[model samples]
Target chain A: MTEFTLRSNLDAMYTVFLARVRILSRYRGWFLMDIILPIFLAAMPILLGRAVAGTSMEGNFLKNVGTANYVAYMVIGANLFMVVSNSLWHFGFWLRNEMQMGTLESLYLAPVNKIIILGGVAMYTTLRSLISFFLAFTLGCFIFRVNPFQGDIGIAFLFLLVGLIPVYGLSFLYGSLVLKLKEAEALINIGQWVIGFLMGIFFPVTVFPRILRFIAEIFPPTWMNNGVRSALLGLNYFLGEWYLDLAVLWAFCIIMPLAGYYVFISIEKSIKKNEGVGKF
Target chain B: MFEDVESFYAMCKKQLIYMARYPINFITSFAIVFIIILMVILATTLFIGKEETNYSFNAIAIYGMILFMFLSDTLWTIGYNIRWEQVQGTLEALYLTPASKFASLISRVTISIVWTGLNCIAAVIFVYYVFGALPFKNLIFSTIVLILTLSGTFGFGFCFAAFTLYLKESANLAANVLQFVFMILCAMFFPFSVLPDSVLKISKLIPLSYGVDLFRSSLMGYPEGFPELLPVNQEFLIILLFGIITPALGYLLYRKAEKKVRTDGSLGMY
Candidate 1:
């Protein structure tokens, strides 16, 4: 009987997931738009290097970064940023969208607990982010003319996989803020830029000031991004060892998700006790 | 004319007073913009060449960033504010008033402008004090440039708000797109010289480039260069044109949209 009940709860959440996928599918142009923007974002740096460095651009990049292929380095950064950004947008700010749609309250009305609904949202976000990630990654690689599967692909994927749980968990904490605030535009807008900055999407965190570097280290996407770059581009890891970096990410995995979940649930309860999640 | 302006001022003041009552809302709104400006300043600083760079006016990038943030937040606030008011059912009460709706809307937007401008001023002081940037000396030119930029900004804001009246659901997307486009195309991070010639030419068509150019010229100490391709004082002319054209177009659009909704009796479609 308990098994049946758990299965039914999962099934109900899946329905919500499917509905979102279907709705997004109806707006197919958005997927293409996402793929295009990252290319342009990456192009600016590549072109700037060429313009500024002139004939010595390749040598300049090779001297600073590991690879002479700055194009590939930038493309990878942009694609990973797409993943990080979409995950946050889908899982974090999507709560605001849900509230505005009045579906947030409807879900809260259900017999299932808040965590279960969050699980459904996280699952949906994960699936969508990865889809966009793969599509943008592959297409961006094609545009930039580089092998997308170069270097320790398995280890890089492992970093991403571990990194995602914490990212989703962080998004839940961000979602809690949206719930309490009842409007998310300012927070989401500010947060994404901060995430992009801390992640060092265009450059390594080593280039940051000492204090900034410390702040960057605590951010999960910074580790995820650095790990991916180190794995793929043969860039130096922060700990001077790939395994050490991976272990730190794992530590973040353990701490952030639990901390995130606790904060989220607490905020959820507070919001419910006050104006509720449907306030938007 | 004075009465129209007075009524609009009164409406704007009332809204500001109401917002002041909710201290958190006002503080958070300003803080968010301030934070965004700080991020932009940081990003722009990263790419600035320490030596052997041709551009003398690197600080103009910071100015562009502040202007971009101010315009984007102010314009975005207009739409979202109206939507929030609509959701709160205060929009109808305001609409039923004897004062003109456009004036009232403009007044509300003016409040956003004042708040966002304060944030920008704070951002400028923070950036200058922290970075020790040289003081801008061309006060009169900078003032004219700011006025023109604001006029152009208000034009775009009015049009965007008019569009929102027809499609309320698109407000968030519109806000995001507007801000993104301004940032990317207007070269808010770096100099416009970084863009390809083709992209640069296209960006010239955007009203934002004038503000960027004027600010860069005044602060960074550039003489009226680019006369052959862009024309001398073209930024002023373009802003002047948009200042006259955009609000009129936006007003017409708003009236048409309002009429359509009234006929259909479905303003609350969202």
Candidate 2:
């Protein structure tokens, strides 16, 4: 007979979150790298553009990308990409780590619902990613000599806040893949890049071909990225209005988590019915 | 010599077989490279506009990317694989064997060359089709430069493997940081002209930077300001010495680290 009270569930979630925080605290270098890598990632293209277009870089960028501030655009893209990537990697790797350590079975056998545990991990991941995003974005702007304070930052933060749910929902789907595939590192490495490409991390989605643009539009991170850039850099929103664009994210908030949960549950059931979750 | 060759062959076979088992890993690695290259290309177009077709710039980026892939592979495959072995608890068992340890270390280079080489070729063809004709010239000279560059890079990989033995778990962070450091300092995705003067001076000091500059500049037919750090002849001389010297120096450092770890009895303690 397992207890399923609200307080107990909340307590269990907090405990999992605290344990992860303590464990991550021991790897301080990883956190530092998370904050630093985005700057370098953004630098490659900024420098490349500088080398190629030289004096006309800003003008050309404005003509094409809808912003003369190429530095801020790239920086925002890179930082947001990192945030989305961290979400996927952390959630997927959490499940994979448990599977590898042979504790996933024990976890499944535990009295608490698996979603509660996942919720805790998602909370921790969200906190870490948002911190990394803000820190890295600010640090990158300073390094590139771009003013970070420009634009409707509050709305950019709003986009990030609304957009995170679908991203985590996508992570749930990714976690299911890790469970089935049992190749976390390779999959996560490739998965992040695929997501980055689809989201147009370094370029506008309009630059993609028609079909590709349609596909990119359906991805929540694409909307999130465009929304952030629109807010911060004054780029036109995908829908030409911020509220409409955010409404799409709002719709994703309802659909994606449910879809992700359904898929995850189905996969979990199939794997358990076959060889069990501990096999990995 | 024959025994060393046999050991190397066996290790290489084992690695290949292991790779073959994971078909997804193979396919995803190929796809990831293409995605990155395309992403960078499209991103560059955002700045230069869609109408511009600077094939010389394309040549610079593509050639630099090829070297970057090789260097990155050398670091991850050759260097980090040692840490992987330790984590798997096989480092000690392998160390106790009578096989030549150098053969075991060098075997990973074959995998890097074969796998990364294929990826680079596919990327070149893909870029050529999508982005128009790239400037391809001085093939024989570029080949020599590439070989020398790879030799020096493999040496750096050996040195990194040694560092892994010393750093243990933290080597992962070190490798990630070092790769980015190399990317920027070597100006792998851009020309030296884009780097600040202070960074360019530091870049000039690193031997690998010369390898990058010379390899791409020669491949792009040494257009005006192609090899930005120094004259072609001077850069080639530097690469020539680097190619010859680094492997010997790296092997010595690795041997020293191996000896120290063995003496400390921490070879298996990862």
Candidate 3:
């Protein structure tokens, strides 16, 4: 395996990124629908809260979830879900689609590292997720009549930036799963929902039992979510301090990508030897 | 007609075999219901009185879920069945059949509805068992409401299926988006009252609105969450009126769309 120059790798990343942008621009309708999805997801729990609690949401929410800004709480959770969900689906499903389209073998023939090409997709996923996240966040606030720019905005941005790395790592992990398993739709669908459930997209981890809470806390997105909510809505952090949660996300950032890359590489070599990666 | 029955039954058997082929798909669908139910139970329990969130309440939640599931499946099968056909390279062959497209659609929709019905029954039983007693207060009336709900959904499904064929390549996205769009606008979980006034007004216009309301009211004896916007009789009248018009409208619209797609020569493009 010859090591490519850094500039060439960067160019490869940019090329893949540009290709994604062009293809996404072509399907203008799907792009718009994807943006609108998180808002609708957020609306479900928000409306359910309205129907259930009536005027008591502020006080009761504070009691249960540690914040009176229940609207923003759910909006943030759902948007984080959008980010995680889109990365997993887009990166993972795109690989599966490429296999079906017979582009996987061509990609393997390319001189640039597969990771660099994947870096391009990961970059594309991040751009798209961030776009959807803010659009839905601001729009949801306006619709729900909450102040969107309250709390520590800078910390929330920092958490989002840090949290995104591990999400990218996990996307590659997901991509590898598709490469090996060859069933993208069901796996991605089920994976996204299970993430949503585990991440406590609608409720705080405080409501989860010991086992569930432990599971959620270990997952970086769960920490990222709590960090954002804690910053934005003044909710309690998982370990009672803002930096403490950020540190955990940082740890995941290192661990998840390395784990994901290792697993992905091992599986890719095996698939190449056996049925080949394009068998899916 | 006898031949039609035979064809339809054959289609039914085919759909059943196709369904059984994908255990993961069925499990995932079943899991979606469970997850949604869990979300409803957890989120509502946090805000409302425990009594309101108890077993009886679950019965109502299950009803809402079943309504959403039925409508979603009905709409999606109609919309997505085409995508499957196109993928498998059978669209051209299917269109080559002498029978009208609606014959095939009817069988598909019928099979889908049966699956959805069974799923709902399973969910209701699960909810009832876990959540305690289900108040089937007005059994005859609830039964009537369920029929009206399914009929309305079925009518909408016809239009959806035809619209999907017209959509060609974009059918899957349309179905996927509309599934949640209906979930939000149609009050599948909360009462229609929880939606903003503008959204509530729109909900009243939706076909699923009346169906969801009817299910909640008749089975759980839950009142309209927002009665000021729409009175009970007015709502029922609108439902009955739509219940009559949708199938006719759907059939006509589907036929018209079918003709247009056929003429445009886009059916085999994808």
Candidate 4:
């Protein structure tokens, strides 16, 4: 392979980034609706808690969950889940959209590498997810009248920042499968709900069975959720220390992205050999 | 009429044969859908476990969700499959045939229904063996309920298919919206009781809920003192009503849309 130039790669990334921002701007209402949807989804549980537990809301919640601030806890989980959900949508479904619109083959014909284009896509998605997360988290706090940035804000951001690497990595793995299968919409639609469940978006992973808990822990989103909750709501960290948990995510950051990229490239090569990317 | 019937059957058989040639397509769709159903079953189990104080999803509740899922998988197939055919340039060729367009369209739906039924059969077998034999106490009643449920789904599918005739590219969007409606209104994963009072009331007005309830009554056994739940027999009445309502509207809309496409000369424009 030839030596890669950083400048050219950055330019390619920026080009892909601009394309995404422009497309997102076209569907402006849908983008805004996503930021609002998670808040409503989280509100149900908070209101239900208040209704069912009445005056003992804090006591009842703290008794089992070890957090008096169930509102903040659920908000963090939901917002983080929104990030996981949207990132997968961005990378996974975007490929399918391109294929459908006859753009995937066009991208394949370009001199620039697929990884550069994917890098740009990932950058755009991360930016959008962070914006949505902040909005939803802030608005949820305002609606529920709870402290949103109470616990270890810096550490929580660190976890989010690291957690995204593996999450996107896994998303690329899913994207490859979508490419091979050609059932992107159905897969993503069902996959999102399954992710929500496994990540314990509305409840703690501690509530899951032992086997389920083990599986959930392996998922990057579950770690992100727990880390955020631990940071914001003062919940117990899985590793019992903030640094240890962050370290695990950091390790995943190194391992998963490489593995995911390998899997995706292998699949793309095999596909190109047989039907070719243009077949879609 | 007899000639049309024969040609429709021929079209259906031809479509089936063409699909069978691509065994991977059918197998993968079946596997992906089965995995999705399995995930829903797990999620439903978790939701029920949180409240029910019992670990088991009664035969009715499980079957109800399974049926809705199966229907949801199939109902939208017509629109999406048509859209794919249109993309492949085969749809225009199909229209150019001597067969009645309505018969050809319905035949496409028949092909999809058969494929979905095969998938459902696989799922049912998986459930029976993996989850153990569900006590389906009223076998004959359950079959009637299943038939009604299938009819109601076909009704919704027809209404959706009409939209595909107008906006070819928007077929995927229509399918997504339909699936969302099934999840929200049908209350497949949770009881209607858990939903907001307003949502619950409106859900009852949708025929899919009655279909779900019918399956629940047959498979899970009717819940104690829950008069609001649609009985198996009552579901038959609702299904009959929807069977008339949706297909009539669907056929009308489809005819109007098809005519407009013909007049505008835009069928192959996309």
lDDT by residue for model 4 (A112-138), tens: 889999999999998999898888788
Best by lDDT: 2
Give a tens-digit lDDT track for model 3, residues B17-101.
8777656777777677677677667776667643444454466567788887887888878767866787768887888987556
lDDT of 1 by residue, A1-280 (tens): 2454788888878877887788678655556556666775676566545545566666656655666767777887777777777777776666887887688888788777667777777888788778777887888888668898788999889988888988987887788777777547556656776787788777777667899999999999999998988899888898999899999998988988788889888988988898877875
Query: Candidates 1 and 2: which is better by DockQ?
Result: 2
- What's the C-alpha lDDT at position B22 in model 1? 54
* Model 4: CA > 4 A from native: A1-8, A25-82, A96-105, A131-157, A176-216, A232-234, A266-276, B2-60, B118-133, B227-236
Once superposed on the true structure, which residue ranges of model 3 sit more than 4 Å away at CA? A1-3, B49-57, B222-237
Winner by lDDT between candidate 4 and candidate 1: 4
Compare candidates 1 and 4 on TM-score and give the better one: 1
What would you estimate as the lDDT of candidate 4?
0.73
Worst 10 residues of 4 chain A by lDDT: A44-53
Q: What is the lDDT of residue A71 in candidate 1?
A: 75
Ranking by lDDT: 2, 3, 4, 1
Query: TM-score for every candidate vs. truth?
Result: 0.85, 0.98, 0.92, 0.79
Of the candidates numbered 1 and 3, which has the greater lDDT value?
A: 3
**Candidate 4 on B168-199: residue-level lDDT in tens?**
76576556556756665676655565567877
| Local distance difference test scores for all models | 0.72, 0.90, 0.79, 0.73
Which number leads on DockQ? 2
Clashing pairs in 2: none
- Model 2 DockQ (Cα-based): 0.80
Question: What are the per-residue Cα lDDT tens digits for candidate 2 across A151-267?
Answer: 999999999999999998999899889888888888999999989999988999898899999999999999999999999888899888999999999999999988998899999
